[model samples]
Target: MTLLEWPASPGFPEPLWYWVEDWHRLLLWATDQAVSDVTLQANQPVVVERHGRLFPVTRRRLAPAEVYHLTQVIYGDNAPSQLAGGQDIDCSYEIPRGRADLARYRVNMTAVRAGRERGVEITVRTIATTPPPLATLDLPPALRAGLVFEQGLVLITGPTGSGKTTLLAAIIRHLLEDPHAHRKILTYEAPIEYVYDFVPRVHASIAQHEIGVHLPSFAAGVRNSLRRKPMVILVGEARDAETITAVVDAAMTGHLVYTTSHTNSVPETLRRLVSAFPADGRDGRLADLLEALQTIVTQRLVRTTDGRRAAVREYLRFTPDLKDAILAQPPARVVAATRHLVREHGRPLTADLDALREAGRIDEREYRLFRGLGTQADAISLPLPAGPDAPEPGEADGPG
Candidate 1:
């Protein structure tokens, strides 16, 4: 699809194709998050580059007839103009940022149906997102470094909007920054959310392919990376049997593969992946999965009193004991085992929540909800050291 070369609206700061910040502002002026997920894709006329990324700014409004004209102008006579009278229209359009110009924003366009009549509104979601740094992951040092070095299936398990993609991005960025490690990184993402910022390598090339835009699914992307001669492969999310099989296969082939799932706990993540196979292929695939399994980290976002949010996380670093249990296909003991070890020095989510509560990093109610505790229960543990180094309650490091 091609974004059109429309005349820049004279009001904005830069000549624009489209931008989410614009939409966010316009939505506040328009109806405040009333727009649907479908949108017209385009490029901004302005070039704003930050840390190796060009953030393209674009905008759109409910002009169905103007959209038809715009599409025909960009796509010529072969455009889907005929579909206008057909009720609901779905397609992508782009403006050729005047040739020799590399587009930072690849706008995706689709029409949302509003009953009998369809109003064309262009919604631009993140085609590529540059996430925060790896050091900011706040992970245990063991998990932060050990996860990338292992040549197995390391999974970050979390529900939607739980920072799984950001975690994966941090891990990939960690690998990319190591000087001696020259590995081709291949990624397959549904909509390709997180974009890497800091990559340091002369020969290391990272290839990211989107699900609908590049290949069909995560399975296809994983299989394709095998032929691309990759050292590191990242699958955005392994939510199905096909994707799970492809990721496991990629790991088993002596490649460092990373993927994620929507499980709240380590054992649950293992069981979810293993059980993705049919009842017939369950045992064999379970063994293969266990053999390739490296680590699982579960994450959740909790709000502080000031309205800012932070990631309270837990990790199950794949050890001999854990791997043995997984290989045996008895997954119930994984969380119990992880909790036991993390209490010593390793960080568990419960422990983190308790710590946050005790330090007033999070209040008792917020901490309890995150700990899966009700309002009536006291989830905060008043644990601290006794020396001058000991921080006071409701304070973590710098004063709250």
Candidate 2:
């Protein structure tokens, strides 16, 4: 059908049973509506989240069999078997948008307890086809400077859905465009959210490998990248000790490495990575991590007065002096020491949020929400003075 002549699909039709093409059309419609997430469940109407609100887009609740068929259509025939084995499947799905572009989604399918019986629920997060330029992100000078290091570990960290992947993608796109950077970049992602096909590789070349589809794991991907002579490696997540160890090894061996983690701030990022190793070897691992550390950026997306979201970032660049200070501390004292260095040489998230509040970019309620999102331990761990709106210990706060 011609673009203009195509049927207008705001929601699903009356039919409870949908074809694979029907689901694709519905997703395209949701994308056009600026929906950020789509949810499908066994006994619920198809729902979409747009502008931070959720609403049903289908007239009828989907049957269990229909949901099963839809999973097969998006994921594959093995999705049912995989979900049956008690493993939630995380993968990427794509549909052609036109002759050259594709629309992509990060998909997760799991078996949910539906009124005492098992049923399926699928969550799909929409991703941009093209990565934005790094300049457009308006990262602070300190954070931007850390991105150019020849060889070290640069971590982009935050809670889930806090724009960590988007930020990392922009950094990779920046590297790919630099005329002086003529480096070979390799990326290991679970589902490969962003594709660099449209970005002109002016000097650097990149190859992206999906964890389950190509390599078996992130650790394996890092090890494999070494054999292929990559100058830069981007790892999707460094959650396990093996992957974290591999990341540190790659950095110490002179390959620039970029990775992400689920963390709240700079001090927490260091603690999480260092604590990943066994206690007997943690001191050595912490020393290696410190030696190879370049930067740690923790980001949070908060609502602005304009009704859109803005990123408030806290970051630390580990200069030689800062690294030495951290290394001098005992293992039990490293986190506290890092917090001290962050205040001395880096920008803290509270400071950024306060500036945004003063400039009227965000409302006071939004400010308080993000300001108090850190854990009680995080609040106690860092030695920085508390913001005016800092929450009490163990007090609940909104998502970061």
Candidate 3:
């Protein structure tokens, strides 16, 4: 057994590494030692990063007996009998041995087969993370451009890990920097992320509340926000009918509101928000929602040439034409119409990618991969605002 040590800063913990260069043995060891509650990965090899350095680990298949023995190492000698009758089970434990330690990983183990072999594989990921920012996130310029609106709805949509919370934090920070924002800002998040330490909003008193931990859910957060008399309300997700209805009413009644969904595009965000209500709420409600909706931004982050990640954004600003389209109820046309507005009012994700390429900020392959359904910056294409519609480049803002 060999031990690898990482040099950590005075306030950080050192990374412990155990490299079994033999990939088969490494997989067997990982499978045996994985603890429940930790995320496990399959096919992909074990990768660990500490400080600024990454540790390389290998992966391979595991035999039942090897898994059993590994389980014994992780759970005690009796693990073999406990897992003997099961093919699918979730179990996890930590084994601390010397400097090469394992305690932080919450592992999920499952059964899989490659070709003719019925073997078990473990996929692993870390559970330790700082709570995601609730107010700031990566946002597209098109959606975030007119963020100063006093009363409207801004919507963000994506699956988890699409960085919705990060975008929200960026938005809050943008407003905090503005001297004109003198009203109170309140946010409701599930396990709030991005605690504001230093913001210059003189008139805005920012308050953050955690759902489940503080309130019941997002619906409750929205209802309570009305009582707070806030100028801006940030709902973590307008997921349910009550929350969507509340957010719509808030926007209509003149308090700007922001929220997120699990949809893909801007038009879909509109459809989803309206359809979330029953038939009663669906009647002419979408038009109202659209009228209050100032912007809907869809964005994703991709790896750049520098080995860091960069955001690409698709922008959609509310115009009289868009409001009319939503009232027509064939909301699907929204995407088609957005292409024109994207060209005219907001620059698309491809425009930013091209600009980054021209400036030598990103590479050709990187730009091409993130081009998405939009135009690349041409000689005539207006430049996209770097980061959120902020004053400089590389800044961030939330979609909602």
Candidate 4:
């Protein structure tokens, strides 16, 4: 069914078409339908993903020229020319909802092989207008306690689409909503996802900076936040060596820091961060990182039996004893030592998955898939039946 066949809602107009002229309306309709992502590819019908499945929204395929024009409209006039330079573009887009309201999206334009010619595909992930409350997240007691630190580093590690941003946002929202806690928070995100203007803050305040728009990179943003006198700093992701060093420095100088990394488990997260430094000074950097570390929580989203998804997490709060235990191990045994210590004093991801399966929150296939993986809990979600215009079998990519 097309957009017109869908019932009219409060702010949505009724006579919307499936063509590019009404692209914003189509996105709004997809949002209303609880779509998580929207894809626009050359010579393909507009597609939307919901509940880990993809389906087409438009009946007719979009021409190459139409997609090119659409790309220009979403980005700037130089978008197509920029894509021709063998580089993908990532930026944010929004539809004006009211005088001061907006529905923002994280958009990416990638160059793909369309027959012998180069084609463009635009993928858009919807951002929630406001972050959910931390109480709704049902985090473990240990994790909740670790968030009360005054000066240390807290990392939420996971792959893309694993709710890392959502988890950080909830924690930030909780800190801001606390009446007794008075502080300043600075955040640096690649493209700001969740806007917090509607959140009612008691005494805490926040300022956000985009990576490219406000600052050149994550490292620069971390360095910039130090001069702003914020009690807490949030770095979007600690990917490179420079950014990791900056995060460690901020934590060292008596400022609470929070960041995300694209790692699967707690031990791997530590290993990855320590390995980012040069080999000559790697041991020193590892000591600094372990000393300033407060907690590392790795999260993954698994498909549930009810067509939704649930977050399974592994977390560790690094006490002095645990830190010493890790440091005492040689380089070859560091990962093994960390794993043993985590199981002894922290929550392993396998236990959480087992609990979910026992409670019937997740099915047996999903549990076995996650349980069989190694330290890196990278497992593909079980494929579901697609919609009317869904892609052919084996064409669907799993969750990002």
Instruction: Using TM-score, give the best candidate's number.
Output: 2
- Writing each residue's lDDT as its tens digit, candidate 3 over 1-400 gives 2122432112222122222223223433433432111222333334543221345443432344454444445445654454444644433333343474333333335555534543444544332222333234444343456555888988877665555666777777767666777878889876565556545566567888877567888888888989988999999888877888788888999898988888655644655676676665565666667768887776666555544456666567787775665354333344344444566666566765776787776777766666653333332345664443232121121111
Comparing candidate 1 with candidate 4, which one achieves the higher TM-score?
4
lDDT for 351 in candidate 2 is: 81
lDDT (Cα, tens digit) per residue for candidate 2, span 1-400: 4222333337445565778877888788777766779999988888887655567777788887888888898888998888989999999999997799998999999998766656899999999998899999988776788877899999999998889999999999999999899999999999999999999887899999999999999999999999999999999999999999999999999999999999998888877887776767777877788899999988988877765678888888888899888777655556656666777778778887888998999888888788864322233553433653443333222111
Query: Candidate 4 regions off by >4 Å?
Result: 1-21, 374-400
TM-score winner between candidates 1 and 3: 1
Candidate 4, residues 129-175, lDDT tens digits: the string is 88999989888777789776889999999888889999999988888
lDDT of 2 at 189: 99
For every model shown, what is its TM-score relative to the native structure?
A: 0.65, 0.89, 0.60, 0.88
RMSD of each: 11.7, 5.9, 11.3, 9.4
Each model's total of backbone clashes: 21, 0, 27, 0
Query: Which pairs clash in model 4?
Result: none
Taking the tens digit of each residue's C-alpha lDDT, what string does model 1 give over 1-400?
1112222232445323224444334322222222212234222122222221233334433345454444454334544444445433223332223453212222333444544654343443322235566887677777776677647888887776566877888778767776777888999876665556434556567888888679988899988898888999999889899989899888988899999888876545655776677666666776687678777778887766554467777776666676674454233333333334444434566766777777787787887677761111222466653654444343321100
Clashing residue pairs found in predicted model 2: none
Model 2: which ten-residue window has the lowest total lDDT?
391-400
Q: Model 3 — which ten-residue stretch has the worst lDDT?
A: 391-400
Give candidate 3's whole-model lDDT. Answer: 0.57
Model 3 segments more than 4 A misplaced: 1-144, 177-179, 278-283, 325-334, 359-368, 372-400
lDDT of each: 0.59, 0.83, 0.57, 0.81
